[model samples]
Target: MYLIPGFLKPSTSFVPFSEKTRSMAARTNKDNKDASGKSDGRPGLGQLAEQHLEDMDACIQNSGLAPDTLAQLKLWQEQQEQTLKAWAKRPGREHTSDADRFGESLQDWERAKATFMAQAAEHPKEDSTARDFFSHSSAKRVNTDTVMAKSLKQQYPNLELVITPARTCNLIAYAQAGLASFETIGESSGKNPESLSWDLYVAPARRLDGAQGGIAERPFFEKYLYKWRGLEFIIYLVDGRDGSQNYPSVINYYILTPTKDKAQLLILEVGRWGADMHGEILVFDGGYWQKSGELFNSIMKASWDDVILEPTMKQAVIDDHLTFFTSRETYTRLKVPWKRGIIYHGPPGNGKTISIKATMHMLYNLKPAVPTLYVRSLSSFSGPEYSTQQIFAKAREFAPCYLVFEDLDSLVTDSVRSYFLNEVDGLKNNDGVFMVGSTNHLDRLDPGISKRPSRFDRKYYFPDPNLKERILYCRYWQSKLSDNKDIEFPNELCNAIAATTDDFSFAYIQEAFVAALLSIAQKSKKPGKSDEAGWTEDLGDGWVGILGGGDADGDLEKLVLWAEIKKQIAILREGMEEKQKVQM
Candidate 1:
């Protein structure tokens, strides 16, 4: 019933009891009670055993374990101590063999662990479970994940097993998106039979369905036998958290299906649909290809009619894109590589961006829908060279794709100039890639990229708007405010505003119109309906705002639009001239 102090040593390896145990065995404490159930002042056997284990702290700590496993072992040791106390109730009566058996059990604990370790070594998984999946983690949780997967495969020989890190291919999320279906088989929900617990919680449901309630619950770690496409498969997912952030904590998926093809088909479809996010455009940023539906929606507003370029130049830009994409045969027949690049050079805000957007919209309307790849920046975790390589690789993949390089002057800096040109001009064929780069200052571009027709085959200049275009812009603003009834914008005011806004870009004119409208809106006293002559309505998307009716010689200073726009145009002109001086 009693064991001496210092019985165990500082290592978990088995060893005989120390001299302290035998010396104590040869004597008995004078305070020790006899088997007649007599009381003594000595501490109970359970208390002594607890103290012994505490004294063997180094031994237990050397076998470092998970908190959960250590807690379980502690509880088991406490229960063993209680059993020894029960035997001590009948001191020296019998059951000395139970004490020996308890020591042997400690050895058995390590023996079983050793066996599991030996088997675990004969497997895959980088020596542990795939715990950490992101940049934030690198730790591995000691568990039976690898062993369990191997055992399951052996147990189900007929079923083909395909294991994947959940991050690489998430089957559960695939089923959740309605891209595929995984119905539970009879009497089984997806919980692994061996698992005793699960991690599940409720999060925002509006993210999944707009009309649904605010919250919905989903399981975190679970397994089930599911029937997908008439094929039975076992899907298991588990969370392997390593207790801290800086460790390898990842979720793993184990799929056991009737055949490898069935598992592969499901995986392929999930990967395809996941990468090709619906209603989203692929834009390069932060060194990766991100899907942006917002960017796609913004480009949808770009119509060629919104661009105030002359018909010939507008049609030239249109044909440059249309003929290239549709005339793959023409390039082949002409013995030239189908790949081509175009540069849209201009003063700021004269329509370089809108033209590019219009081209993107035009491509989207074609049969089978050509995708567009937009590049915003070259800054990334990897260097800019890596960014350039990935950009071209993706462009090649999505060929017949419009690859836009907005603000090319700033993007292709001296540090990456050579590398950037290599990707664009190297031996690799970039056929079907209608690459376009826009820059406000064409002089800033390198001659290798700017002057060479082999690179950018054509350059389209988007200069400041001419007088006729400015007149049409003002009349369009007049039509927009015709119903306001506060600002009287007569036909003469359009001509007067256009006459004064020389050397101004369309952006400056738009700013003038907006400033004038805002000034009118802020006035407390609204202008009454005009006694001035109004022109016939010419409401169309085209540049037909020069409708004739009101006299060109009529007074324009009295008109509200004319008055407000004059001040705005003066302010804008001053700012533009200052900018020009600084540039010089």
Candidate 2:
């Protein structure tokens, strides 16, 4: 009891129907009938027609045809589908009534019929010509039907299938098959049409066993594949060890070919680009580099205006370097390498890291935003030299970029001294590359890596803020604390705090403010504190016995009287003294 839908028209060719196609159609009809009783409305006409087309396509593909002929058929089908999609989107004549809609449909039908007649006229009724024309047309229709069916299946695959543009397929292939299976396709010039810097032709590689752990120890295994979703893919697996523990991670890559679904492809590409454009701060760890997520440091929110530094230091270190990075052509004209390096040396808790964050924020917001690559440490890799090469290679790939090497002395150890120096000032050009390295103990670094002019040419000292700078830092905290209406922050409080904290670093001052405000909040909720005077008294003498202070009305003995804060500052000062003693 099979019902053939109206849309399932028999091919207008002399070729006989295959038994396979008939059997497939019969099986589909039986499945549909079993799912729904005859009393129930007939199965969806569209679904039945789609099933018929799928069956016919399967039969055609199984037919013995030359590989080139099949390829030509596939290409023609793709063109027809593209043309139909284009026609569907064309603006039709405006209409106001049902008659107008019917008229538009009639016109479309006429145009399609006329096109078919014109094409048929090209091949006359002569026996040889008619046979060739019929075979070609039948093959073309079958290929079109197969493509549509495949598209439907792809849209709702039974398995999880990831799809990406063909361009990035090699990245995955390289991971799966290793470098041996790929050949460089083409490199991009400055005015290349493609956005990719290079192309790669990757040979297909199947699933391979990837193992992690030392041979002496028990190893864990994972699988890497080179194909997925009827398309090429590269699966890469990374294994690392921490002491006795094994950590493994996998990366998958899929390459999607152009298809009739233009809208779907566009959406996927746009989403990928959007994800990439969002800035990333990468750190090398576990023998590889990985994203640590978005840059969200509180200090980054602070601009140059917020930092309290000597005017001369700011102008020379921050301002001058910013100008040098943005002036690319000027460096070229001077026949100088378009690479600049600066070193910020200071005691712990000064403005080194804060200034770095502010600078990163500024560079990130530039016209063509500069990406920041932060290398936390290279202790995990086999050799610091290898890690250094990897880091610099990445920086080169993302040129016009900023590289931050924190704790330069620790990273460029004695073992990797030569390698670090070479990468920084080697024969290789590092155009549009700006580097900032910070170290608390500048003397610890090797003179070759630290003192080398082309490596870290300019060194800036971040000394403890002077009295005026301290006052400004206090004022900054004052504005911040005023956000809470309950806390009454006075200008005199900031001035007195600034005066008392003579040698305190900006970090210590910030801690003091935080402790004072927290104490005020806690004491204000206590039963004894009713009036504002009680709150003031609680804050003024928060650090009892540390500093002699009782009332809030007169001269304050200490900038921050919180007991815990006093302990923290004492510990910080002790540490700084110990560090200075060691250096001396």
Candidate 3:
């Protein structure tokens, strides 16, 4: 039998029981206070207290507490009960009945004994010691069913929570609770209720080639995946880093339009945007996608560009992406009943890809806490030469995900374009897959792909960032510089650079700064130069090769620095432009 120190005494000299037990006991006595309410029922309460004291004495004689502890206990109980009754009555509600409170305490004590006996029976004595040590302190036993349900409730508040085999809990149960509750609203409250859902982990993508395939199912998986309604949206992030090359992290999103015949997965070629590396992936459900495209196109074609269109066009791009996403009314008005395709056409380095990312943030409301999936390339999936429909059907199994295709036009050729046309115009148009494609040579795009009305009715042209865009670009770069502040790009100098940069993309602007800085460093390193801050203003100007900077003479003076700057800018721009010209 398990023993509580001393339950039979009302002493003024002992260490007391726990705050929880004393409070509960006080409330029980308060409930029994007679009409006079002057500790009228002390005798009855004392009888109950005495019974507890005897039980503790019996157990202590066996081992836990000493005989002197009995006197200490009696003194402590009398002192604590007086304060507890007053505290209980202060609340003004009828006090908790003595029977209910004591019954619960007894149940707790009995349950602890039962668990101790069970563990001792199953394990050897030495192994049981740890369980006994913890149990002795009065911690509640872990009731598997209750614990599991409570955990599920806390993780997924929106879903109708139900668990079979109540005692079972695992990562799978945790994941399904999220998936089933994806479309739900409201928070959950109750014991072991769910908490916020941050991410959903699916079974790892597997390949069936050469004796390496098997079926896997967890409890919640069996319950949720097959029953998902609406479109299966998926986005993927592909890490593109190689030791030799540096590339920004890229993520792509796609939605699968399911059909009985086959599934077609459409890729959004424009990239999404975030303030930082830890930003959330935005999902433009079909509705958000269509509306955003319409509003964006209308603004581009209208005077909004003239009023807000600064040279580099950076603000316009950010604005267009944000405008559509921030307003739900706009989303509802522009969203189509069926999914529509979007095409992003622009020059290299003008953020054709980044625009897609920003659009996603807007679509998903840029809420950082939500979990999203990003698939960088379609090639990652290996299956039978499946139709587009099949790929999407498989993707939805990983739903609440984004399916992104970096560059789609290149993937679809004249011949393949026809196949793609058939899939989109085919029976699978309503699956939840969102499609987007980006291209540099819009004119060269196969007319068969472009001419279709709703196939890709929205075409966003990302021209080189104009003057205002140039300023914003400078600001963006400045914030990325030593301090997180926008440095003023000298207007005359900026205008000259903007005008001279006929078709320069944002990438080229970055290169220009790098070249200028390198020129300064190289000049300062020249054999005779004592100035460590690099070249003087005159030399810096001469190195950049602006007009009236004594061209031939200065060029001769700083030949090596000039050459290095020119080479650095040209090589970087040329390489990036050429690579971006190709479709992903």
Question: lDDT for each of the candidates?
Answer: 0.65, 0.52, 0.40
TM values, all candidates: 0.65, 0.53, 0.37
On lDDT, the leading prediction is 1
TM-score for candidate 2, residues paired by index: 0.53
Per residue, candidate 2 scores C-alpha lDDT tens digits across 186-252 of: 1122121111122344433322344332322211211123333344322211121212323332122
Worst 10 residues of 3 by lDDT: 265-274
Clashes in predicted model 3: 76
Clashes of 1: 13
Candidate 1 per-residue C-alpha lDDT over 1-584 given as tens digits, one digit per residue, 9 for 90 to 100: 21111111112233223444433433323234546757455543334444455444433355443222233344444555455545555545243444446556556655645543443343211112112221113334455355546654544445577877676577767777775566432111111122324345545534634553344334434555545566667776666454656446576767877678888887777677676647778999888898888778767766786678877999999998888889999889999989889999988878888788888888898886889999999999789999999999999988889999999999999999999998888888898888999999899999999998868899999988898888877766666555544456677778788899999987788777666655755663634323122322222211122222232344676666678888999999999889889989
Q: Candidate 3, TM-score vs. the true structure?
A: 0.37
Measure candidate 1: CA RMSD.
15.7
- Model 3, residue 372: distance off in Å is 7.2
